[model samples]
Target: MKKLFHIGEYFQEKYSQPLQRIGIDLALGCPHRSNGGFGDGCIFCTEDGARARHLTRVGLNLVEQVACGIEYVKKRYGENVGLIAYFQSFTSTNAPVSRLRELYSLVLSQADFKVVIVSTRPDALPDEVLDYLEELNEKYELFVELGIQSACDRTLQEINRGHDFAAVKNACARLKKRNLKVAGHFILGLPGEDFNDWMYTADQAAALQLDAVKIHQLMVLKNTVLAQRCNQNSNYVKPLNEYDYAAALKSFLQRLPENTLLMRLMGDAPESELISPRWWMKKGQFLSFFKEYFYSDNTQNGNFVLTHTADGTPTLYHPRYRQHFHSLAGAGSEAEKKFAEPSALPERLQKSASEKRPLRLLDIGFGLGGNSFAALAHSEKVSGCALEITALEFDLRTLQAALNLYNPNSKEFNILQELINNGFCRCGNSEIKLLLDDARNTIRKLPEKSFDLLWLDAFSSDVNPELWSQHFFAECFRVMRNDGALLTYSSAPTVRGGLFKAGFTVGETPSFGRKRSGSIAFINMPQEGFVPLSEKEKHIIFDSTAGVPYSDCSLNAAPEKILSQHKKLVERLRRRGVPKWYREKTVKN
Candidate 1:
């Protein structure tokens, strides 16, 4: 898993303790809501513009609001935690420099805050305001949080954002020029936006290389234009579920610079105020979920939970691997598109039937047996040829859990329990031999030139680098027939380079629900219909330091050892200017 930088971690390193954030709403108001600007604020703007709930009394001055917020935080979290004064709500810098100085100074006098953060619109920051904030930061730690909701200008117009992406770019440039820390506040699942649009926002945000970022899933609140629009047209807004939102966030987190601080990852609102997407969890629960899914190795944890994919099929998610047994987009769809069809399982089975022989298949990391079942289903429809499946799995708990999971072919799945009991079984017209062990150990025991189709559907190379190393690929190459094909969903340069090093002709397959294409390798010359590597993939494989493959001489080293060796090799190569060609290629393009 990629390392993420969190604000709590930052505070612990710098201040030696966590900081309890205090939200102070100055009631400066928004320019877009005023008569001089658009006269109507953003569609998602609420009545209070997200004011802190504790500061509820009307006509409270800056000092009073600060006092109320301090009392509220200190009561909830003991007095020992440090405080960070957050100027939240209603375009914090919309007022004049004189008024802003007076409001900002109130929090400075408290002498309890270690840092100050002010949230405002990108268009609200003028040169005069930037100069004043820079001056203020010279004496104290200050951060400017700009609301860069979406990178797509079209979505900005659809939401009546009253600004463009250019404004955000300009504001960040000005802030960075002053050496002030900038944190971007981005929202996913906005109206009239898709996953690609959200990724565009993340990519652009990463390009800016800001000091920190706060990401939130859009929550429709009562009395907001978004809620009314959703009421009028059901399709106006569709909230992301936990799985999809986590998938998007995973991509977002992977793209960010490792040093950038993650201030927030989820949205929060009072139950009474939320109008849609009611799956809000408390901060503790949310952080626990984040750590469990993104941080833990889960090697000792065997709990497997059933989850439904986009194609409405049951799949299992393992906490240890921090990945689902199948793709979240569609478990069954991935089995067909990325595995069966790409490998031509059906066509190969037909050829075997003509020769009066069973088609041989080797399923490595056969979690829930989706790939095998998909191939079997296709072969049954095409012909009556027997399909011989040798499945290698590391965890028996996943296989047991799959027995209770709902699938279209429940009867065939139920027969899989026989494999658990007897290590072999007959399911429909297929012969199944299950090897319950790690693939690295099990693949070596197989005979040479045995399998015709190999499904390398293991966890990602990031987590399971052992399975994708050159030594393991050499074992795969020995077991596979001369005319066989190996297919996997990973398109990482190291995986491809390992295949090449193992003496296989590598190609590509159309990816399913992902940006990068899947990989296809052949022991012999690839067939005429196979797609060659794209230009970008070719460059990565030959020119970049990223193409360096992991090596394990014994083919049974621990994942940590393999990853460490690969990282050291890459660093050594980098110092030798191995990636210079790739850098120059990118620049030329």
Candidate 2:
């Protein structure tokens, strides 16, 4: 069997003693031309791969590069292990086969190193190079990172990638045939690309059977062609809003193949080098914003899918709900009602003493620390024990905002900050720690069957179909303790069906505010009083028309196809005596 080493795994093994990464520049030219090709390389390409010059040094050969990488790794990680030689600059494999072999051999000569990763363009790989890479696979771990910004050719050409879609497909096929591990790179929010394009790219990567994938938001760097274009026409560059980026990422991860390793969900660009989309320059703050927005109790991105056209273009599916929600939040009346009451609290703990054990909670979105604050407020009246909160958010800006809002002067804020800062925070009189980043990405990293209460607040279902899918819910089921409960504000029947499919016993809990209906709650295992699905409901389970076979997190799959499949299931259920609620009401009318 061929041994596969992921770039991340290689780095982890090499720097096992600590967290450190080194970027090595190959300085190889493009194959299309002896001189550099047109359009100044892809719009997103940067001179240093966005690394600081002072932090990195240039090397002429593979030996010097490896040595420089090693020196940096040692300095940062204290030499307990080896180094990960990252071939980052330009296309590492755009040279002759003989030259490629020689350079690879030089890097492998450093026996202390754990792995050597080559980041190259898909079109640059040749058969002879593959043979050499296979040979290197036997001695040292090898990972090939391929840049495939988007599956859409129009978007590809818009960025001047210089290769067609066929090139990426062919290269991936060749790499897979060799049993070599492949990592795909995608940039979200590129010029002329929107959420649909991003979803399509993710679906394509998933369909391509990639071993791993890394996603980066499009950053307009100073001195780049993209920046020049933006300067020429202010409207040429369209940057993603902080909310949009987080929602897009959440949906993207949901569609990703289950087994594929996500090397990165976002990347950092130096604020000084960034020219447009000033929001992205505040990478930390942007992430924090995403974290907080997604971490609330009842948010999911379901609406994103609804807003997208059958062909992946943005459209307004239902303007009424958007208006309704905005009005609700703006009125303050609904917001106060929804937030004033504690909806997900267990009956036993509803009236518990302040000295009781701290509530063990799991927060899915963790957007801006608002949910955490709410939890803290509820905990104050209940018990002094540890809150044991684990929150997940995909954006870095929201997390930074949370950190900033964490006041050292205020006792409550200080305690929250300390928990986040110390990796885990034990409240002065309680225990509560906040886990940062995307929930779906971070779910498996958590201790199995550990959470007592879970908050499933993400974007609306329209915005994030991946998070609302059956697979994500299944993972949620795996992580929750037997008696654990999950709470979310979504009242959509399809969302509830997904939770049911994931093995949770679902029902409605009291609403937070003046809404006539309550939010949804699911138990890891059904409670004694919980109602079993009626015969009609069971028919809905098998009713092809009612729900669709859930799509994994790949963006390439057509939503219409999935929805069609779901329609078929619903039709089957209808034939099986599943009475429609609307039909019944119509008959009465």
Candidate 3:
């Protein structure tokens, strides 16, 4: 596995231990701010001026800020960890040379700090500043981080970044000439830039031979010009999703020099201030993606891209559906919570074992067999239990990707491998029949009243409505025994209504990882474990137009056709006029 040349590794190699940066605000503000106030700062700059959350430099002196920063770091990490004095907030070199000397000398007085880091814009790095930094580098290790947000001059102008690419080039040239270590801060997904533009920026940054680089995602923050623009027109800023950002970051890392240390990969804006691109990924999660990018084959079989869910299990993103194979919260976790527990897998397995019969399961849209494997693993725990699963899947490339991902349950993993390679797999008392075709076609041929439990793990109704239609639910109801229950991760009103329309008792399941609860249905009266929907939920399904389910009597219609028909049905229903009480109640609620 290829490892990232990270700042931590570089620090450990040079200083014998990892160094934690203590961000210190010098209070020397940005020259780009209008009237030298926070209101008209750079479009992306927040009022905090990128200051450390704990340290407010309003009253504290340079020495006092350094002391507070050190205390904060030691309290979080340990007393023995090495420290780096970081002049982080707005242009650190905006002040005169004499003032800079006093502030720099004051912070250097602390014997515990091993290095110094100063962050400023490319335009702010004058020759005098570079000359002084060179003198300081002779005595102690120091790095000058320039805010090179983009390489495209048009994009720089669009973001109100005062400097252009030439400024970055000139700044790097002067810094290198004086033997000063240079670092560049680049942001991906900026306004008016596409994938090629981002690539150009990365290539330009690499050409500078930067000693270190900090890559950030352009985030919309509160009380910024970007936020105001977003309020005016919502689509003005659309951030890259996790998959695209990972691809861009990996490509960016590949273009950088092998020795260039990666200071940071993604941005970490305070949630309270952030307005867009709210990915909410922690440092560790981002690093896991970094490791996955370098080690794993991200683009697999030319059909899917590999990504990790909340529980760190692998899942694939389908380009055609624009959906992931499993929930982002957790693939295995979703399988166990949303399907196994809701369907009462353990109790059913025990009953089947006691009756000396295999528990029959219908796994619909079984992309990668997460639900199947989880069920089999649960069945494995019940000693004498036997399980027979009929898994229906559409894509063959998905099965190929599943074979590549590592699973902890060796038995289940081998079973999936066998099922993919062959048509069926028999291991001990468990059997899985793999049907590689449209679920709508294969489901019609299934024996009636055969399955004891059904796992309806399909994509969202908007993208794959053919599987979630009333007709499909009726087919699932036909196959399930009277006592059998169907469980799905979707709590959409249309899905519950479809189940209700198909002569099944519907209820909500305990929610996991998302706001909406999962849905459970039964052919007859609901089981004791099922919680009935509230009156409002029922009203939306039975009375309101929103509850109207997609209809595909033929069962094998294209998704686009089904979706278009469903939209027309909804429009016609709305045109027919809704009852006043239902309309008011739903609107008020």
Which sections of candidate 2 miss by over 4 Å? 1-20, 32-39, 47-62, 280-589
Candidate 1 local lDDT, 79-134, one digit each (tens): 78888889888788998898898878876787578888989999999889999899
Compose the digit string of candidate 3's lDDT tens values, residues 124-207.
877787778888888778899999988999989988988789989999998888888898998888887887898898889888
- By summed lDDT, which 10 consecutive residues of candidate 2 come out lowest? 317-326
Look at candidate 1 and give me any clashing residue pairs: 298-320
Error of 3 at 164 (Å): 3.0
Q: Quote each prediction's TM-score.
A: 0.55, 0.49, 0.82
Which candidate leads in lDDT? 3
Give lDDT tens digits, candidate 2, residues 1-589. 0122234564565556543445665556555432463225776666444332533454345566556666766776686755556676677887888988777666667546555677888888889889988987776667788989889999888988889778899999999899898889888888887778788887888888887787777778888878888889988867764445666777776677766766676666567987755552256655454444444321333332122212332221112122222122222232223332433453424533343654567777665455565666656665433566776766544444444334558764565556546746655454555566556667867777887677776666655555677777877878887777776766556777788777777766545433533344456454434434445544544443444435444423444555555556667767876644422124543
TM-score of 1: 0.55
Which candidate number would show the highest TM-score if scored against the true structure? 3
Ranking, TM-score, top scorer first: 3, 1, 2
Model 3 global lDDT (CA atoms, 0 to 1):
0.84
What C-alpha lDDT, on a 0 to 100 scale, does residue 146 get in candidate 1?
91
